[model samples]
Target: MAQKGLCWKEDEMGELVHTGTSSPDISVIRSLAMKHLPGSYDTMDVAFFAEGSFNKLYCVSSPHLPQDYLIRVALPVDPFFNRESEVATLAYIRKYTSIPVPKVLAFCSSSESELGFEWILMEKIGGVPLSDIWDEMPVEAKESLPTEICGYLKSHQDLQFIKIGSLYFSLVRERVGTRDFGETSAYPSLPIVVLSHLHINS
Candidate 1:
Protein backbone atom coordinates (compact mmCIF):
# COMPACT_ATOMS: atom_id res chain seq x y z
CA MET A 1 0.00 0.00 0.00
CA ALA A 2 1.07 3.54 -0.62
CA GLN A 3 1.89 5.77 2.35
CA LYS A 4 1.45 9.51 1.93
CA GLY A 5 3.82 10.86 4.57
CA LEU A 6 7.53 10.64 5.23
CA CYS A 7 8.81 8.78 8.24
CA TRP A 8 10.12 11.29 10.76
CA LYS A 9 12.09 11.14 13.99
CA GLU A 10 13.02 13.57 16.70
CA ASP A 11 16.73 14.05 17.16
CA GLU A 12 18.69 14.75 20.36
CA MET A 13 18.20 18.45 19.78
CA GLY A 14 14.44 17.92 19.60
CA GLU A 15 14.41 18.72 15.92
CA LEU A 16 12.20 16.64 13.67
CA VAL A 17 14.23 14.91 11.01
CA HIS A 18 12.93 12.85 8.16
CA THR A 19 14.34 9.36 8.70
CA GLY A 20 12.62 7.10 6.21
CA THR A 21 11.78 6.91 2.58
CA SER A 22 8.17 7.50 1.73
CA SER A 23 6.17 5.12 -0.43
CA PRO A 24 8.65 2.96 -2.30
CA ASP A 25 8.46 2.14 -5.97
CA ILE A 26 6.10 -0.82 -6.18
CA SER A 27 7.47 -1.96 -9.54
CA VAL A 28 10.94 -2.33 -8.10
CA ILE A 29 9.61 -4.19 -5.07
CA ARG A 30 7.75 -6.59 -7.36
CA SER A 31 10.89 -7.17 -9.36
CA LEU A 32 12.71 -8.06 -6.15
CA ALA A 33 9.98 -10.59 -5.34
CA MET A 34 10.39 -12.22 -8.71
CA LYS A 35 14.16 -12.47 -8.30
CA HIS A 36 14.29 -13.82 -4.75
CA LEU A 37 11.01 -15.70 -4.23
CA PRO A 38 9.63 -18.76 -5.97
CA GLY A 39 7.50 -18.66 -9.09
CA SER A 40 7.01 -15.92 -11.64
CA TYR A 41 4.77 -12.95 -11.50
CA ASP A 42 4.04 -9.91 -13.66
CA THR A 43 2.60 -8.17 -10.63
CA MET A 44 1.80 -8.87 -7.01
CA ASP A 45 -0.64 -7.56 -4.45
CA VAL A 46 0.85 -5.15 -1.93
CA ALA A 47 -1.03 -3.61 0.93
CA PHE A 48 -0.01 -1.67 4.00
CA PHE A 49 0.11 -4.10 6.87
CA ALA A 50 1.52 -2.05 9.74
CA GLU A 51 3.91 0.67 10.81
CA GLY A 52 6.07 0.95 13.87
CA SER A 53 8.56 3.44 15.23
CA PHE A 54 11.40 1.96 13.21
CA ASN A 55 9.80 0.35 10.17
CA LYS A 56 6.86 0.14 7.84
CA LEU A 57 5.52 -3.21 6.78
CA TYR A 58 3.62 -4.38 3.76
CA CYS A 59 1.90 -7.65 2.99
CA VAL A 60 2.61 -9.06 -0.44
CA SER A 61 0.60 -11.81 -2.08
CA SER A 62 0.99 -13.35 -5.46
CA PRO A 63 -0.94 -15.88 -7.52
CA HIS A 64 2.23 -17.79 -8.33
CA LEU A 65 3.54 -18.06 -4.80
CA PRO A 66 2.36 -20.56 -2.25
CA GLN A 67 1.84 -18.04 0.51
CA ASP A 68 1.96 -14.40 1.40
CA TYR A 69 5.16 -12.57 2.37
CA LEU A 70 5.89 -9.52 4.48
CA ILE A 71 8.18 -6.70 3.52
CA ARG A 72 9.75 -4.59 6.29
CA VAL A 73 11.51 -1.42 5.32
CA ALA A 74 13.60 0.31 7.95
CA LEU A 75 13.37 4.02 8.69
CA PRO A 76 17.16 4.53 8.34
CA VAL A 77 17.68 5.77 11.87
CA ASP A 78 20.90 3.76 12.06
CA PRO A 79 21.07 2.78 8.40
CA PHE A 80 22.86 -0.42 7.41
CA PHE A 81 23.88 -1.53 10.88
CA ASN A 82 20.33 -1.66 12.21
CA ARG A 83 19.06 -3.82 9.37
CA GLU A 84 22.18 -5.96 9.29
CA SER A 85 22.19 -6.67 13.01
CA GLU A 86 18.49 -7.55 13.07
CA VAL A 87 18.88 -10.05 10.25
CA ALA A 88 21.89 -11.52 11.98
CA THR A 89 20.04 -11.71 15.27
CA LEU A 90 17.24 -13.67 13.67
CA ALA A 91 19.69 -16.02 12.01
CA TYR A 92 21.55 -16.56 15.26
CA ILE A 93 18.32 -17.27 17.12
CA ARG A 94 17.12 -19.77 14.53
CA LYS A 95 20.50 -21.44 14.54
CA TYR A 96 20.63 -21.83 18.30
CA THR A 97 16.99 -22.22 19.33
CA SER A 98 13.49 -23.28 18.34
CA ILE A 99 11.90 -19.84 18.42
CA PRO A 100 9.59 -19.41 15.45
CA VAL A 101 10.85 -16.17 14.02
CA PRO A 102 9.92 -15.18 10.51
CA LYS A 103 12.28 -16.72 7.98
CA VAL A 104 14.14 -14.16 5.96
CA LEU A 105 13.75 -14.77 2.24
CA ALA A 106 15.76 -11.86 0.93
CA PHE A 107 17.15 -8.58 2.19
CA CYS A 108 19.15 -5.54 1.20
CA SER A 109 21.08 -4.03 4.06
CA SER A 110 22.01 -0.96 2.07
CA SER A 111 19.78 1.84 0.95
CA GLU A 112 21.53 2.14 -2.41
CA SER A 113 19.03 0.08 -4.34
CA GLU A 114 16.25 1.27 -6.61
CA LEU A 115 13.91 1.34 -3.63
CA GLY A 116 16.17 3.77 -1.69
CA PHE A 117 15.52 1.86 1.53
CA GLU A 118 16.75 -1.23 3.30
CA TRP A 119 14.10 -3.94 3.17
CA ILE A 120 13.67 -7.51 4.22
CA LEU A 121 11.27 -9.84 2.48
CA MET A 122 10.28 -12.56 4.88
CA GLU A 123 7.83 -15.39 5.48
CA LYS A 124 4.67 -13.86 6.86
CA ILE A 125 3.82 -15.06 10.37
CA GLY A 126 0.05 -15.18 10.45
CA GLY A 127 -1.80 -14.35 13.64
CA VAL A 128 -3.63 -11.45 15.10
CA PRO A 129 -1.39 -9.39 17.37
CA LEU A 130 -1.34 -10.59 20.98
CA SER A 131 -2.84 -7.31 22.18
CA ASP A 132 -5.90 -7.87 20.04
CA ILE A 133 -6.68 -11.30 21.50
CA TRP A 134 -5.31 -11.17 25.05
CA ASP A 135 -8.51 -9.99 26.70
CA GLU A 136 -10.62 -12.70 25.07
CA MET A 137 -8.44 -15.64 26.09
CA PRO A 138 -9.64 -18.31 28.52
CA VAL A 139 -8.29 -18.09 32.07
CA GLU A 140 -6.17 -21.19 31.61
CA ALA A 141 -4.74 -19.84 28.35
CA LYS A 142 -3.92 -16.54 30.03
CA GLU A 143 -2.26 -18.31 32.90
CA SER A 144 -0.12 -20.33 30.53
CA LEU A 145 0.95 -17.33 28.43
CA PRO A 146 3.70 -16.13 30.76
CA THR A 147 5.19 -19.62 30.90
CA GLU A 148 5.27 -19.77 27.13
CA ILE A 149 6.91 -16.36 26.95
CA CYS A 150 9.45 -17.31 29.58
CA GLY A 151 10.32 -20.41 27.57
CA TYR A 152 11.44 -18.22 24.71
CA LEU A 153 13.46 -16.05 27.09
CA LYS A 154 15.08 -19.14 28.55
CA SER A 155 15.98 -20.33 25.10
CA HIS A 156 17.84 -17.08 24.51
CA GLN A 157 19.66 -17.50 27.81
CA ASP A 158 20.73 -20.98 26.79
CA LEU A 159 22.60 -19.71 23.77
CA GLN A 160 26.30 -19.40 24.57
CA PHE A 161 28.51 -16.79 23.03
CA ILE A 162 32.07 -15.53 23.59
CA LYS A 163 31.30 -11.84 23.54
CA ILE A 164 28.81 -9.32 24.82
CA GLY A 165 27.84 -7.55 21.64
CA SER A 166 25.39 -7.34 18.82
CA LEU A 167 25.45 -10.25 16.39
CA TYR A 168 26.36 -9.69 12.77
CA PHE A 169 27.26 -11.76 9.77
CA SER A 170 30.92 -12.75 9.91
CA LEU A 171 31.75 -10.75 6.82
CA VAL A 172 29.79 -7.71 7.94
CA ARG A 173 31.55 -7.51 11.28
CA GLU A 174 34.93 -7.86 9.62
CA ARG A 175 34.09 -5.08 7.20
CA VAL A 176 32.91 -2.83 10.00
CA GLY A 177 36.38 -2.46 11.49
CA THR A 178 39.80 -4.04 11.81
CA ARG A 179 40.25 -3.64 15.53
CA ASP A 180 38.48 -6.21 17.66
CA PHE A 181 35.29 -4.62 18.89
CA GLY A 182 34.26 -7.91 20.38
CA GLU A 183 34.89 -11.08 18.39
CA THR A 184 34.28 -11.94 14.76
CA SER A 185 35.88 -15.34 14.36
CA ALA A 186 32.90 -17.57 14.96
CA TYR A 187 29.81 -15.40 14.99
CA PRO A 188 30.51 -11.76 14.23
CA SER A 189 29.92 -9.30 17.04
CA LEU A 190 30.16 -5.61 17.74
CA PRO A 191 30.35 -4.33 21.29
CA ILE A 192 26.98 -4.00 22.99
CA VAL A 193 27.82 -0.48 24.07
CA VAL A 194 27.93 0.69 20.48
CA LEU A 195 24.49 -0.69 19.75
CA SER A 196 23.18 0.63 23.05
CA HIS A 197 24.35 4.17 22.38
CA LEU A 198 23.04 4.08 18.84
CA HIS A 199 19.59 3.24 20.05
CA ILE A 200 19.72 5.67 22.96
CA ASN A 201 20.77 8.58 20.80
CA SER A 202 18.59 7.75 17.85
Candidate 2:
Protein backbone atom coordinates (compact mmCIF):
# COMPACT_ATOMS: atom_id res chain seq x y z
CA MET A 1 0.00 0.00 0.00
CA ALA A 2 1.25 3.49 -0.84
CA GLN A 3 1.71 5.99 1.95
CA LYS A 4 -1.00 8.59 1.54
CA GLY A 5 1.19 11.34 3.02
CA LEU A 6 -0.49 10.47 6.28
CA CYS A 7 1.76 9.51 9.12
CA TRP A 8 2.07 9.94 12.87
CA LYS A 9 4.50 12.12 14.71
CA GLU A 10 5.01 13.31 18.27
CA ASP A 11 3.83 16.46 19.94
CA GLU A 12 5.70 18.45 22.56
CA MET A 13 4.48 16.05 25.22
CA GLY A 14 6.00 13.14 23.33
CA GLU A 15 2.54 11.76 22.55
CA LEU A 16 1.69 10.60 19.05
CA VAL A 17 0.33 13.25 16.73
CA HIS A 18 -1.40 12.12 13.58
CA THR A 19 -0.75 13.70 10.17
CA GLY A 20 2.24 15.61 11.49
CA THR A 21 -0.13 17.88 13.34
CA SER A 22 0.76 18.95 16.89
CA SER A 23 -2.04 16.91 18.38
CA PRO A 24 -1.91 13.97 20.66
CA ASP A 25 -2.43 10.46 19.25
CA ILE A 26 -4.28 11.43 16.13
CA SER A 27 -3.47 8.25 14.18
CA VAL A 28 -7.08 7.18 14.09
CA ILE A 29 -8.05 10.57 12.71
CA ARG A 30 -5.33 10.46 10.09
CA SER A 31 -6.52 7.09 8.85
CA LEU A 32 -10.13 8.18 8.64
CA ALA A 33 -9.22 11.47 6.94
CA MET A 34 -7.03 9.65 4.45
CA LYS A 35 -9.76 7.12 3.74
CA HIS A 36 -12.77 9.43 3.41
CA LEU A 37 -11.01 12.60 2.31
CA PRO A 38 -8.03 11.35 0.38
CA GLY A 39 -6.04 13.98 -1.58
CA SER A 40 -8.27 16.67 -0.15
CA TYR A 41 -5.86 17.16 2.71
CA ASP A 42 -6.08 20.42 4.57
CA THR A 43 -4.81 21.71 7.85
CA MET A 44 -6.46 20.71 11.10
CA ASP A 45 -7.86 23.77 12.79
CA VAL A 46 -8.14 23.40 16.54
CA ALA A 47 -11.24 24.74 18.21
CA PHE A 48 -10.56 26.57 21.45
CA PHE A 49 -14.27 26.73 22.22
CA ALA A 50 -14.46 23.30 23.83
CA GLU A 51 -14.75 22.78 27.58
CA GLY A 52 -14.15 19.13 28.33
CA SER A 53 -11.47 17.04 29.93
CA PHE A 54 -11.75 13.85 27.92
CA ASN A 55 -11.43 14.83 24.27
CA LYS A 56 -9.61 17.27 22.03
CA LEU A 57 -11.94 18.37 19.26
CA TYR A 58 -11.28 20.24 16.05
CA CYS A 59 -13.45 21.98 13.51
CA VAL A 60 -11.96 20.73 10.25
CA SER A 61 -12.74 22.40 6.96
CA SER A 62 -11.40 22.23 3.44
CA PRO A 63 -11.87 24.30 0.30
CA HIS A 64 -13.10 21.17 -1.47
CA LEU A 65 -15.92 20.51 0.99
CA PRO A 66 -18.89 22.76 1.45
CA GLN A 67 -19.33 22.40 5.20
CA ASP A 68 -17.20 22.03 8.29
CA TYR A 69 -16.98 18.93 10.50
CA LEU A 70 -15.81 17.86 13.92
CA ILE A 71 -13.09 15.41 14.75
CA ARG A 72 -13.05 14.15 18.33
CA VAL A 73 -9.82 12.67 19.56
CA ALA A 74 -10.36 10.24 22.39
CA LEU A 75 -7.97 10.53 25.29
CA PRO A 76 -5.91 7.54 26.29
CA VAL A 77 -7.57 7.54 29.70
CA ASP A 78 -10.96 6.93 28.10
CA PRO A 79 -11.11 3.12 28.31
CA PHE A 80 -11.91 3.38 32.01
CA PHE A 81 -14.90 5.51 31.05
CA ASN A 82 -16.02 2.84 28.54
CA ARG A 83 -15.49 4.84 25.37
CA GLU A 84 -16.30 1.96 23.05
CA SER A 85 -19.49 1.25 24.94
CA GLU A 86 -20.58 4.88 24.69
CA VAL A 87 -20.00 4.89 20.94
CA ALA A 88 -21.95 1.66 20.56
CA THR A 89 -24.80 3.05 22.62
CA LEU A 90 -24.85 6.19 20.50
CA ALA A 91 -25.01 4.07 17.39
CA TYR A 92 -27.93 2.15 18.86
CA ILE A 93 -29.73 5.36 19.83
CA ARG A 94 -29.24 6.80 16.34
CA LYS A 95 -31.12 3.91 14.78
CA TYR A 96 -34.49 4.71 16.40
CA THR A 97 -34.58 8.43 17.21
CA SER A 98 -35.15 11.41 14.94
CA ILE A 99 -33.65 13.76 17.50
CA PRO A 100 -30.67 15.67 16.18
CA VAL A 101 -27.29 14.09 16.75
CA PRO A 102 -23.95 14.35 15.06
CA LYS A 103 -23.68 11.77 12.34
CA VAL A 104 -20.92 9.25 12.95
CA LEU A 105 -19.01 9.46 9.73
CA ALA A 106 -16.13 7.22 10.75
CA PHE A 107 -14.31 5.66 13.72
CA CYS A 108 -10.77 4.44 13.99
CA SER A 109 -9.05 2.43 16.70
CA SER A 110 -5.50 2.80 17.92
CA SER A 111 -2.60 0.60 17.02
CA GLU A 112 1.18 0.64 17.28
CA SER A 113 1.61 1.26 13.57
CA GLU A 114 -0.77 4.23 13.67
CA LEU A 115 -1.33 7.07 16.09
CA GLY A 116 -1.87 5.41 19.45
CA PHE A 117 -5.15 7.14 20.08
CA GLU A 118 -8.73 6.49 19.02
CA TRP A 119 -10.81 9.14 17.28
CA ILE A 120 -14.18 9.69 15.65
CA LEU A 121 -15.28 11.86 12.74
CA MET A 122 -18.75 13.35 13.00
CA GLU A 123 -20.73 15.81 10.92
CA LYS A 124 -21.03 19.13 12.68
CA ILE A 125 -24.48 20.23 13.71
CA GLY A 126 -25.75 23.60 12.57
CA GLY A 127 -26.86 25.10 15.87
CA VAL A 128 -24.94 26.15 18.92
CA PRO A 129 -24.35 23.62 21.66
CA LEU A 130 -26.79 23.90 24.55
CA SER A 131 -23.97 24.83 26.88
CA ASP A 132 -23.06 27.86 24.83
CA ILE A 133 -26.54 29.36 24.64
CA TRP A 134 -28.30 28.11 27.75
CA ASP A 135 -27.32 30.95 30.06
CA GLU A 136 -28.47 33.69 27.70
CA MET A 137 -31.93 32.24 27.09
CA PRO A 138 -35.13 33.47 28.74
CA VAL A 139 -36.81 31.60 31.58
CA GLU A 140 -39.55 30.40 29.25
CA ALA A 141 -36.95 29.05 26.87
CA LYS A 142 -35.28 27.35 29.80
CA GLU A 143 -38.58 25.77 30.76
CA SER A 144 -39.05 24.46 27.24
CA LEU A 145 -35.56 23.02 27.13
CA PRO A 146 -36.32 20.42 29.74
CA THR A 147 -39.41 19.39 27.86
CA GLU A 148 -37.40 18.87 24.73
CA ILE A 149 -34.74 16.95 26.61
CA CYS A 150 -37.34 14.77 28.26
CA GLY A 151 -38.99 14.06 24.93
CA TYR A 152 -35.69 12.79 23.64
CA LEU A 153 -35.22 10.69 26.75
CA LYS A 154 -38.71 9.22 26.44
CA SER A 155 -38.23 8.28 22.82
CA HIS A 156 -35.28 6.09 23.82
CA GLN A 157 -36.95 4.73 26.95
CA ASP A 158 -38.09 1.67 25.07
CA LEU A 159 -34.52 0.83 24.10
CA GLN A 160 -33.96 -0.79 27.47
CA PHE A 161 -30.92 -2.73 26.47
CA ILE A 162 -28.42 -0.64 24.60
CA LYS A 163 -25.91 -2.80 22.74
CA ILE A 164 -23.24 -1.22 24.90
CA GLY A 165 -23.54 -1.17 28.68
CA SER A 166 -24.18 1.87 30.88
CA LEU A 167 -21.46 4.53 30.85
CA TYR A 168 -22.93 6.22 33.90
CA PHE A 169 -22.64 3.03 35.89
CA SER A 170 -19.04 2.67 34.80
CA LEU A 171 -18.27 6.17 36.10
CA VAL A 172 -20.04 5.47 39.36
CA ARG A 173 -18.01 2.33 39.78
CA GLU A 174 -14.70 4.02 39.11
CA ARG A 175 -15.44 7.08 41.20
CA VAL A 176 -17.69 5.82 43.98
CA GLY A 177 -16.62 2.19 44.20
CA THR A 178 -20.02 0.82 43.32
CA ARG A 179 -21.19 -2.08 41.20
CA ASP A 180 -23.67 -1.99 38.38
CA PHE A 181 -27.18 -1.99 39.90
CA GLY A 182 -28.93 -2.58 36.59
CA GLU A 183 -31.60 -0.15 35.42
CA THR A 184 -33.30 1.99 38.04
CA SER A 185 -36.96 1.34 38.64
CA ALA A 186 -37.68 5.09 38.58
CA TYR A 187 -36.35 5.68 35.07
CA PRO A 188 -39.65 4.95 33.36
CA SER A 189 -41.56 7.36 35.55
CA LEU A 190 -39.09 10.16 35.00
CA PRO A 191 -40.11 10.61 31.38
CA ILE A 192 -43.75 11.21 32.23
CA VAL A 193 -43.08 14.87 33.01
CA VAL A 194 -42.16 15.48 29.39
CA LEU A 195 -44.35 12.89 27.72
CA SER A 196 -47.47 14.12 29.46
CA HIS A 197 -48.17 16.31 26.41
CA LEU A 198 -48.08 13.26 24.20
CA HIS A 199 -50.59 11.52 26.45
CA ILE A 200 -52.96 14.52 26.30
CA ASN A 201 -52.80 14.56 22.48
CA SER A 202 -53.49 10.84 22.29
Best by TM-score: 1
TM-score of 2: 0.53
Provide backbone clash counts, one per model: 0, 1
Q: Which stretches of candidate 1 lie over 4 Å from their true place?
A: 1-21, 181-202
Across 1-202, the per-residue lDDT of candidate 2 in tens digits comes to: 1122235567899896554234554444554565665355555443433525556776766666667777776655433234444554466456667577777777654423265556667777888678998889999999998899899988877655423334342223334233444443434332111110011212
lDDT of 1 by residue, 92-198 (tens): 77776768899999999887777777899999977788899988999999999899989989988887655455666656644444234554344444322112212
lDDT of 1 at 11: 84
What lDDT is obtained when candidate 2 is compared to the true structure? 0.54
Clashing pairs in 1: none
Which regions in candidate 2 have their CA more than 4 angstroms from the true location? Answer: 1-22, 25-34, 38-51, 78-81, 111-113, 129-144, 162-202
lDDT per model, in order?
0.73, 0.54
TM-score of every prediction relative to native: 0.76, 0.53
